[model samples]
Target: MTDTAPQPIDLDALPEEDDHDEALTTFRARVGAFELHWSVDAPLSVVMTSSSHVGRAGVGLIEVLTSAEQRGRTSQAYWRSAVGERLRVQGSHITSDGGAERAVIVQTDAVSGLEVRSTVTAPRGTTALRIESVVRNAGREPVVLTAVSSATIGIGRSSSDLDRVTWGSAASEWLAEDRWRETPVRELLPDISLPFHGQDGRGHAGVTSHGAWSSGEHLPCGYLVRGDGEALAWQIETSAGWHADLSQTRNGGVLSLLGPTDLEHQFAHELLPGESFTAVPVAIAASAEARDGVIAGLTRYRRWLRRDVAGEALPVVYNDFMNTLMGQPTTEQLLPLIRGAAAAGAEVFCIDAGWFADPAIGDWWSTVGEWREATARFGEGGLRRVIDEIHRQGMSSGLWLEPEVVGVDSPAAARLPDEAFFQRFGRRVQEDRRYHLDFRHPAVRGHLDATVDHLVEEYGIRYLKLDYNINPGAGTERNATTAGDGLLAHTRAFQDWLVRVQQRHPSLRIENCSSGAMRADYALLSVTHLQSTSDQQDFLLYPPIAASAPASILPEQCGNWAYPSSEMSDDETAFTLVTGLSGRLYLSGFLEELRPAQRDRVAEAVALHKALRGELADATPFWPLGLPAWDAPTVCLGLRTGSGDLLFVWDRDAAPAAFTLPDVSGEVEVLFPAAPTDGSGWRLATTVAGLSVATSAGLGARVLKVRRG
Candidate 1:
């Protein structure tokens, strides 16, 4: 007789029992292909699991124990998973036997899988639970798979009034058998059709418009929209591309797909049957607080999650005001720019990319090792003078440093032989105009520390813009042993260096940029202040780029505006300025190039932004009204403050038509300027109970700042 012990078919098929009868809510079981355990404490639960086939071949085994919870009031959830060989639990927190709780493990059963482990302690007032899962492949065939342990929350009802559904193009067609139909959410207010482009080419279609709710057949994710009120939801989906999908009932939230939209980061493997893989998916829930609360909660939880796995800080928005180095900048020219920006209300004046030495520009790269300014550029005591000037302007001074990059012909490169650099193939590879520095070396860390220390102690530099301009080489093909994992190791090590450096200089802000969008992960966000969305400084592209930014990225972190450039029109420029007002504003254009009227317009816009800064930072973008057309006019509407009661409208064209503010009630104040050119020149239209009329006639722009009376 065959020994049939009823083996589990899949890891999730494992039976779990809720022991509410016990003093501690405990759950322990050996599921189909793995072992799992969980316990709950009010709002949170603790879990632990162990499995050998949890990843691909040559990948290490995964032993993770974590705490998961649904936070109350805040409308957020929390998760902290620690990965290692052994899982040890003490009360609510879990750690590895070696106490290396924050380590990340790469596992492969038949294919590659990554597991990041960490611990989560309950927040000050919340109750908590512990949950853990061990997933393994008990089959003989290699399997390419994406596995995620997810917790979903459904508030109120799950029907049409509370939930709505939409499908991607592929998913929509597949569901056509069921007569899947789509309606525009903006139809109720036809005058406010949102101008947006969906993936592929089809515009957004509301799948639940007929007051119905449905789920995606293949994807396990879904959406819910409240009927009378607003609805907000967040989901972390893992496929070939890891993405965090944040959507709401009123407007389409953000779908932040990792890597590039065109490129696929597939977690493929030839699974040898019994091999298993695990992906951690994080989901959070909250009431309708304009989604800002959701973003804040998620930001907090992500920070906590990353801290548990890696003891580092995430990036923050450290705005820089300087332009890129097509050429060198003298202290005299740079100082005035910094001072002017400070006077213009910039908190941080960053001296951008060109501050360092580059031989191509007639000046030899001098500061790569010294971290001091080249005297020839400043005439005397360059860096200190610049720093002092920034302080005098009542703003923080920041300097850009690409520490991981070394110019091949630089003196620093000549002094440090091939051993100190990362080599590809046989010869030392060069990406762009620089060679990579091996941060894994202790000597390298020491050098970076010293360089940062000099800037902090000598010049009172409080912000550092660290730009990684190159990609990683083939680890295995580049060098044997752990050197193959240099990309991973360097990232981890660089984070460590950041933590240590920040500890020594607690006030210093660090912004990370890898040619722009690269290296923007939860791991890096924890340690730095901001991540550059792109290298291109064209304001024309800011709207689309910003529209794509996920809610996970705080309004403050969005890199919206660069500088005062002439490439864009006054209306286009105004649009860009308005978009940037919602995020960290960085200036890059030369003020000297602006015409008198343009300068005045720029100054007024900046002042207006300052006045409405709080509202712009706090409000959520509903739908974009259309872009300005050559024939007709265009307007952009946004809700500002007052729990959906206030509205802000921007007339983007020379000729403005009447705009009906949507869903606004009570007495409201409408503000617009008589002379659009005058910063302080405004004409107070009537204070109306519901809606008001405003007009614009000339080529400039107009802003209607409406507030509930």
Candidate 2:
């Protein structure tokens, strides 16, 4: 291997020009694999390579320079080599148009020896260029390096005339105090103009620092910002080993790439003295749905990078037949109950808990992983009978399985022996309500894989509600030392098993539940379709829960609704049903216990939700009204598709109180669900021009449907 470094070429002597001209000499352009000398103004040239492995086009490499004068305010540029095969660039430059200057620079490295190659294309009539980078590393040594793709936008007369920037991701955050992480792009920048600042005084309020890696106390990374003025630009810097940043400035907002820092740290490789490493970064521009399209495209790219990850699709609705129909009913009994629910507007008949071998188990503390049919309770082939019954009723069957825990007296405990479960200090470790399973153990994973496969293939179960009853303990060293890779491996393996199972059935859906909503995370979201919002089933508690969820998630992925339990009042039940109607609704009650009139009320509520599912999915709730329960009357309003909309109000006590609505105007219709018929009856009154209400306080329960007139 040669120890000599390639001679550094000085870019200071490059010429500056407003446009490329044929007279330009000293500049070289290469397309695909082949290289040829050409003038600056010449139509883009094409080249082919020798290796069929390189395919028809292989990769594209271009090197160009003008007189140093045209380079503009050239900032810092330095070269460093840690692995000996790649060259890293660290610096910034200034570009100006119409007297406004913007900073731009390349934040990563260029490599010649790469497991994967990339292609670049620039079509006419587009303001932004496109680059596509693909890598497939099969070497013993992992490849480790940051990929920072940068672009410079010419300052225009107005920011509105420029392309808008939008990002696609499940979550985003600003580097606040190094320990802080925020979700949802809107929260990170409540105001579009204020830059988001970090502890080190590096971020601006309206600006978003998309990606970063901590180097002890300092953060080396990239950020993106939208330019409402004229010019927009960006920079990415990596100090130690790996980093990534994709930045763009358009009319809407600035979108960029963040996180996945751990991927670079773990997978980057080192080059032998004489070997070479290559890196490619791509950027594409679309005029419509830019953010969604970009995010979707990036998701596809990441999935391809991770070996084409695909999740099972299962859509379902929750209802009260499980607990009410026949608590732990036999297969013969449960089948009809499930069929009844299917006929009563349930698309997926979910037989929640209490269906296994032991009813004595409480709080999920025992009987997990028993995976046996309750022959006494379910009759023979009970599970299969229920599944078949659901299919016959024109619906899919979903069964609950808490595979991450085991009971002290479970058959699995005796059958697998102590070595199979997680242990600490010679004692089995317990968490929350159950004994934790050592997923790090291949044997444990194998057991779950076999069980799930059997359930899916034998019973024709299309939806599996996999519940985890315990919190993860301090993982074993064998798993922890893997940099959470063991946990990630367990997750990937579980997903891989599901994928294989899905390939066979092709209609399986998986819902992940971990002692309610505690395990809600990106990793889980990537694998499962729906998440159990929380164990708090009372419908009255949903508003607070829904509000708190935005702190960590998007509402679309969150499951919340009104569930009528045996302990609620008539007024409480109406409130619960109405509030839950605004979300992904689920029910848990005794259908037989309801009076005929009450049953009709529930049917109407369910029907309303089914009809407005599209609107609810897309609707955003305005600020809540009234104090918690402290205020006499509690009200919540959510705008539907039209400008004038619906209002839900509940009166907790007997006293009458005044209320106000914000951001609303014009005529309104207030429909009272219930009210007193006497002279002391609830009345319709208005305190403001845009506000009006119909009263029914004496009525046990009421729904005032208000619309602006």
Candidate 3:
């Protein structure tokens, strides 16, 4: 925590020599709990490894692709490029980022005039290293970069170790999000016995995201572990395209993380003379203690990255969207919901989509712009009346907005010029009959800024639910060399615009919802107040998502939806409430239509959340039964806080049985189902190492408070 910056120690044994000599000079620097080794030689090689790691071998420092020098080896592809091996080390130094120590290494390729300054950052008190590269064209001519790596590090010491490794990452969809997959490394990459042939393998196994929805298909976080359980987990923090992979090299097996490339995402960046391009930020957390430990380290880093979040400054929100209005909102439907939400202790009431739609205008699906209130919907006063009702109920009002797209038939589509929209090949990019707006264009930014200001100023809103529905493949060709480059620019501009909007309304809270986590990357979370975890309507399917989301997102930012309807039994209603209690507790469903007991259940859950939210904000998440599977019968999540810890367990479709929680012996009580005579037979008792949970069978859940003695 001291202001004294870290110094890089020279570990090279050889004496000083000219750059022309074949002699090697190596240096080391300790960043947080990790060590980085920099070797200055013919081909500059840098290895970032856990300080406690048994091996120090790793791949080259940089893997870059230029228009002239493509892949050096078909076998190495993204792992090995001609320019990467030709770049000679210029210098290495230490720097500081917000008081935390960092290291920057400089390398240059004279032929291409690509000067790369790779910066390594260690967030204080976390075992993660944030890596980035800034490539400047120092030559007299321009250089087109087809690809560049933010981080390339060895994950294995030898071929045998590579085969024995295991890896896992989360796969996501609209309703089914954060489904984790773990498998043997051999399944993804086959060992070609490189030592016998003295060659690096050409083929690689990797995950690449295209289009604007960064997490639409797969999350940008993953991990690799060897047989002894030494593990490394990483996350690429970008809202646009990203790539990460594992491949074989002469030195060892390396994991290369990058943001957008010509070969994959149709991304190309042209750096003119004296100009520079910075690669996306990627981070890695290593743990000698393995999978769970590295995941914990990654969680801690995610926390440190967004420590200035203002979500806790806001109040719990109740939106009439999931399993309720479903976008068909009117005066009759909303007044009752608003009253019920307020009665159930919701501090903010959000009216989801369709508020501005005039059903008389041909269903108004593709004509949703204008943000004007529909007079026919609310008896002349329209949305203002609804907003008034929300205010009268003593709750702040919020609205849902898909700010990045304009319906093709909307007046905005014609008002904004073609330059404001994303266009490729002389045509606007239209997906699902909606045109994606390029945030890089000033007109687009102006329109969104005006829309946000009008909504906040007119309605006096305290919260905004910003949603993105379309994934415009690649990006526009208006102001960039490639589609990927344009996407990168637009994403950056969008985040900047978000910052400006927050500045305009300092007390306002923003929620990032991309059709439910299709774009839940850190670029948005780092700026926005909260993230909608998923759009999953079924309560039966949300436990796994809520349980596993802490691996990549902070528990405080997870916006798990809880919609309890009159159709659900008392136990069923309580089950969904537990899911909401796990995270930010986004409430929904028809509370006004429920019976008195059902309303009491909702009220009790909301009350408990308000009491424990202070703890949830600073707590660290852990799994008692490990991370849950999609259909796992029993799922348990524990939150360790400065105050007594909290444990959440779900008996999904399992018969009434007993399960054990590890390393958690304490005074335990069911915070929910506070009254024991409710006939659920759920009891938490102390065991030798932890607690024994025996709950009533046939789909039930519990919220238990644990005070360790």
Candidate 4:
């Protein structure tokens, strides 16, 4: 190892190999503001010595466990695996593009016969480093890959000082999404004073998502911060199931990330000869500031990774679901609703469900496959009239399609091959009367492709709300080695299919909805246009869900529903409309039944969202009152855009409410409804810290556009 200053790397220049025999050597690469230094042993086994963030020194050692099963292989108490210093470097290189540099290091397992390739990329002017791994089977026989590590790095401190660390994770569900809380490392893993307590830390903290729904269980993200403002945030960008583990290493703390495992999630992918499986990508960002700084860096990295998508203006969509219609949409029922949605300024009118269901059959869920217009429900002109009416109102026509599922009773179910659907022991894995379609099969993909192509070409559909309702346990064991392996392959194939669908239908705007927000992950969010934040029907219970949505998804792509009905109070209508305006306006409810005044409130919110929606594309979110608690009476969400700041203040308390906003000083004006005609006035005053806002009415919310004057 040399004591020379770090030097800049030229992409065109050849990298000088620091070849050593039975000796320790170091390899260095300058990526943006961070300097990555690797310690390579005699067998080319590399260990990250430092991944420094600017002026700070690198913290944490990445643990690599080589064995599929955890046996006593190494002295390191990191895990239950026959681990070793076994990363043999085969080759390495550097590439530059779009103000970023990527250092690709290739490694191989001599005994196990697995080729592991690591890509460490860093964008210019940022301290964020994105790391991803790909594992390929290079053996003669089949190899079962139980776990492929995305990242395993220790925190930059001693074992005794682990008390200074705080860990954060988000618990997500149907209505209760994005509930984040922090816990101290000392409390999570108590210090063990015994010398024979095994060198590893006392306990482990981890999060895992099971089945097809990636975010169904827990969010694939976590953050570790020290009391001294140093923080490390990471996210697993997988559409399928994944996990992130943080445990005690002898040094400080170690973090390991992977897409499922044999022990957890019934995941063991058997790789045939010459077959390679690319693990889910995980990103880690270092910030010397705090948890907020770490989140901001990770957000930027997410944006950079999503630069290739067919992104366009985020449009306000109206679906005839939720309280109104509720999946029973006929031509007669949808025509007026479509017209009303357009009148309310909705840019897309999606006919959700029942469109393909036969009216004769009471239940529509099971008879789902062949996506034909049920003539019994639609009448003479059929569903075309509803779509034409939507276009007539100057809105795009969107349809709901659960393209991956086929009912056992469905006509198409019998037509496709047995391999097209998920099967176990030569039997289809049935869940809730629906058999999950295996996207890995060409026949399954062909059926979905035809359905999408027909909808887009025939009906002139510009938008698609792709929904997945059921979770068929692990996956199919037929035609694959492991059920988990089969699921992972299908997940990857589904993502690839989405890209191909976009390529074929370039202008189609897809909304990723799984029952609700179950499958909301970067694997789909990175490619899809929008995400349905939640399916919470109670307007009172929706504020927290909508407020916390930006933490899990991009504000521009979060389709928060504002399902206002004619049966609600004026204040209640305003509250729901405000919820929709807070994120991407996903208008629902009985718009056709609303009175002029109620409709006007909805229109006002729509107008306000239209004015602010453009800024949402580039806006960064900040919570003045912290991330919304699921049961919090009052919630506030702030979006800092290029133009100005937009603050959403909700008063769900019994009486009047006041908010102490952070870093906001201006003459705040209620942008929606122009002036409050309901006799409720909002008072805004400047304070030393920020701004003080008090609303006259309770059980209401307001969207305030801040102007510093």
Candidate 5:
């Protein structure tokens, strides 16, 4: 909390430089409770180790393997031995932002003529450190980089306390998403024997994503928890593929993070004499208090990273997609929905898919280009009337667009050149009749630009739902050294295009969706506005996904759909609305068919959401009943916002519902629904453990607003 204002710290002025213990050179700094230490092999820069959350004693706990590969050898970064060559430190320095933010820079050069600059930064008021590495070609000849480390952290050697490390990661899919599991490290590397083995560990455990959809396969984030529950959590922020591996080192364990590598991602890029490439940024946060503490650090960092891009207050968005029309919408179907959405207090009314689908075609997926209004489906001037109606109802008009895909049966498939599409082995890459567009091509950009411009200018649209459905594996090898390199290049190009589009239309809001939560990568989320939490049609099964979304995405930006139908019971309607009110409220379903009571419930939920929206912007998430299990009958998610804390609880099986929340001395009030349904009331009492609540409304949910006593 010094008034230093981010000035450079002199690296040579430190008192301990001349007074080194043995051959290891130590550089240390205090960033809150976290102590960051970096060590160098005095004369040779071959071994530079960096560790964070170091205790008061400040011993070397983490180790990073810095040995250079043999000349022209295709050795992967984490899977190689540190015996061939060594790297020499070129320069080192530190800087501070005058607050709690500080950064340490270490520059090194390899004998193979490769220059690497690694920077580690700890932002203001957080226990997390962000690391990024830039590798440049310093030689006269072309050098191929197969694997490069983004950031690495080491924990313990052979300590029994560390041996019980448990790792956790999330598994995702189209409907079932955010399924997290924690297991012992021994189970991950069972074959690797323990005790006295060289300086490095026997094996490693990690999760890797291989395509543009970073979270499609496995979330690029995880945690390592000791037996006592003290944990260190980390996340890799990349739109393309990424890898994070944890392996036991001589006296500890090392967690190494990298973008796309040759082994897992088929990534290899050639660097010309003066060419340079920067690895994706990764962050590791620590918590001594509890597991939730680790999540809090990451949550703060996620908000900090989005400070620049997350513009304005997020409002309730009603998209007529999942569970509602299901892509079959017309002028007749949308007019009533638009009015109903506005009446339900939606800030934005988005007409989902089938707007451009040919009326004659039975399947709309194949004919998904041109981005034009389907006049046949919506009588003459039908679509325009519905859009104007939405605007007249005091709501912003929105549209859903799958811009990255070109259906094989669409006219644009024949219009755009083959070079504009992803190619492998000189042939176009098509998955399920859809060709992926390579943003590196100008034609692809031009098409999407014109589409967006027309949608915004002609229709007066203010919001857009940008969705990607298919994954074309790695990437196109056309005009690139490797498929992964091309994919990464294209991914960056697409992000750049999004930036330009946003610049052109500063007021326009874009929602990032990938058939659900697949492509919820920071590379896209950082630039976009809202993220679709999941596409789970079963409202009962969506609590876990909605509750855990804050772990990966910001709460205000998590667009959890609440599609309540007339067929649902009163409790079911309230349950669904609670899910929406808990997050951004991506509203949907047949609102026109609902009873007056149901409509009032929906309207009240939207009102509660609007009231909570401002507080949600600064809220930090907490799990009252632990991280929700996918099939848990009782689940609760709490958010501590500026005004107060709000706890959302859902009872699925209609059993006796009781929840013990975290310690919060206060008077709790039901903020949503305006009135209790079925004349049932909630029982609230304070206990030694925490705030305990019991509810008589079976199979229902509620958002309780806390007023601190």
Candidate 6:
């Protein structure tokens, strides 16, 4: 503890010897906006504390639990492990480049021979940092790692007031995705009276995601907020399995993050000598601006993570799947839609699913994987004619592809080797009516590689909606140590394949869609150009998903569907169109069959999104009405831009009312449905405190442009 501000010092530079062997030697370093202080004493730890506020700083830097060794903690929580406490710090240093500062700390458990090289990178002008660790089996014998930490840090208000903090988490599903809830930390981890008993609490609060959907059931992101306007946000970047926990550590609250664990996901890695395993990446952000500001910081961190992958122009895409073709697109059905999409201002027309199946047979779910045109369904030039028609209309062509699965009835099932499929207990992994392919296998990779190449070269396709519809449970144990380790390696290998595909065809745009937003994590979005935010068809349910998606996904990458039909009222069409306008507009439905007014509305929405999308690329998303709840009558999402702010408001059965929006002022105007009678009805005025928005009730949404004066 120092009275004056601490200065940068060597992390391993121990202080003068003290009489007590357990005496702590404190080291301090400024990493971006965070002032990290660590103790190079017996149990190595790091904490974010500075002159303004002191947070929980005594967290064990890393934790590794193995099958043979004793469980780290007496409780089931993955913290305070014997290995974590015993691991001695080896070396550490800091490096700066590209407006970010990075710190590398290496440690090893001499008995277990596990060497963990942990890195923390903070982007300039942001109060957040990205943390990840690579563990290597430095010993002579193999070790079955049951659980390894990707990020282990302490978070909360001052140590004494930690229990007062509240945390927000997400519950995701196929149709109902991005349902967020905020609860007090005490509600999950109550008061165990650690000081009275002199022991850390046994019970813990946490979130875990299993199977292939990195964001299924629960998103791999959450936030902790203190009453003092201080906040900490975190996201585990993985497309496979992930786990995060919040537990008491006597130092306040410890947030432990891991990829997969034997205790939870049947994931155990048997690391051989010299072989290394890099855990999934996790980003942690801190802010004095409360929950929204912390999320804005994470948005910045995500951009920093995608430094190599450039942001693409947000194109209005028309897919013939939702509420339209329903995945059974025939040449007769798609030709008119392609022409319609082009006329309605869609830059890309996608034929979603059923392109290679015969509808006569019905429910072709069990006969996919062979990416070929079904000759009988399409007339004349077949699928190519539809694609050519799209090109002739001055729009790019896109196709739906589920490259990860092979159906039981498909010819590809017999063509690929058994080694190419996920093997568990000597049998290929089957879920629903399909078998999951092991991308690590050359045979499997080659098959998909050729399929993509054909689509890009022969078909002249510019966009691809790569959809993943099934989860193969635990992972393949074919060529790996344990099932969990295999799953982790398999996902990582798939990322490599995506990189190769993008490198081969740099101009092509690949969309990341996993049964909707199930797999919308940074692991895939970092490489892919766009993310399908959800599969929810009801426009009423979509506002929450689109408004809340930016907490873990970038606003520019959120491909929220805007499917409008001829039957919908003008107001209803505007409602759905505004959802798409909130992020990257994904168009669909029967645009060609719509009345002139309805069709004109869709075109106008596309034109508006195109004009304002440049602001979306660098904008920071905040929820003026708080993170959208599934049943919230009114939901609001605000994106802070350089010139001003763009506010997206949704009203679903809420009384015609007004709620104050935060940090927005100056002149305001309705951007979409520009004319009052065109469809939208809204009022916006800059209040003395901030901005006031009024709207009509019953399923109406509006996008307002706010210019700060």
| lDDT (0 to 1) per candidate | 0.41, 0.40, 0.81, 0.76, 0.75, 0.82
TM-score per prediction, in order, is: 0.58, 0.55, 0.94, 0.91, 0.91, 0.95
Instruction: Tell me each candidate's RMSD, in Å, in order.
Output: 13.4, 13.0, 3.0, 4.5, 4.1, 3.5
Distance from true location, Cα of 510 in model 4, Å? 0.6
Candidate 5 local Cα displacement, residue 410, angstroms: 1.5
lDDT of 1: 0.41
Once fitted onto the true fold, the runs of candidate 2 whose alpha carbons sit more than 4 angstroms away are 1-316, 319-344, 360-364, 379-395, 413-446, 474-476, 479-483, 547-557, 565-568, 616-657, 665-709
Q: What 10-residue stretch in candidate 1 is worst by lDDT?
A: 207-216
| Model 4 residue 325 CA deviation in Å | 0.7
**On residues 166-193, what C-alpha lDDT tens digit does candidate 1 reach at each position?**
2221111111111111223333212222
> Which prediction has the highest lDDT against the true structure?
6
Candidate 5 lDDT over residue span 9-44, tens digit each: 235533343344432345444444454444454211
Q: In candidate 3, what are the lDDT values of residues 102-213, reduced to their tens digit?
A: 7777889878888998887788777787888899999999889988887777665567777677888888888888888888878877766788888878888888885898
Local distance difference test, candidate 5: 0.75
lDDT tens digits, residue span 1-709, model 6: 1123334354344333322343335555567766555555543455554313323445676788888874566887888877777776677777788678877778788988988887877788777888788889999999888888877776643345667688889999999889899999888877766777777777788989978888988999998888887888889888888998988745477788888988779988788899898888888888888899889999998887787885377788889999898888898888889888888888999889999997786899999989998887886788888888999999999999999899999999999999988989999999998999888999988999999999999889989999999989988898887777788888988999999998898878889988998888889988998899988889888999999998889999999999998889888999999999999999988888898988888989998988888888999998877898788888888998997889888888746877777666788988877667556566667878788877776568888888777
TM-score of 3: 0.94
Between candidates 3 and 4, the TM-score winner: 3
Pairwise TM-score winner, candidates 1 and 3: 3
Q: Which stretches of candidate 1 lie over 4 Å from their true place?
A: 1-164, 167-327, 358-372, 414-429, 473-485, 531-536, 547-550, 565-576, 592-661, 664-709
Best-to-worst TM-score order: 6, 3, 4, 5, 1, 2
lDDT of 4 by residue, 163-242 (tens): 78888888887777777878898787777752356566546767788787788778888788888877788888887668
Backbone clashes for every candidate come to 66, 46, 1, 3, 11, 2
Model 6 residue 404 CA deviation (Å) reads 0.7
Candidate 6: worst 10 consecutive residues by lDDT? Answer: 14-23
Comparing 2 with 6 on TM-score, the higher-scoring candidate is: 6
Off by over 4 Å in 3: 1-24, 42-58, 96-98, 678-680, 688-690
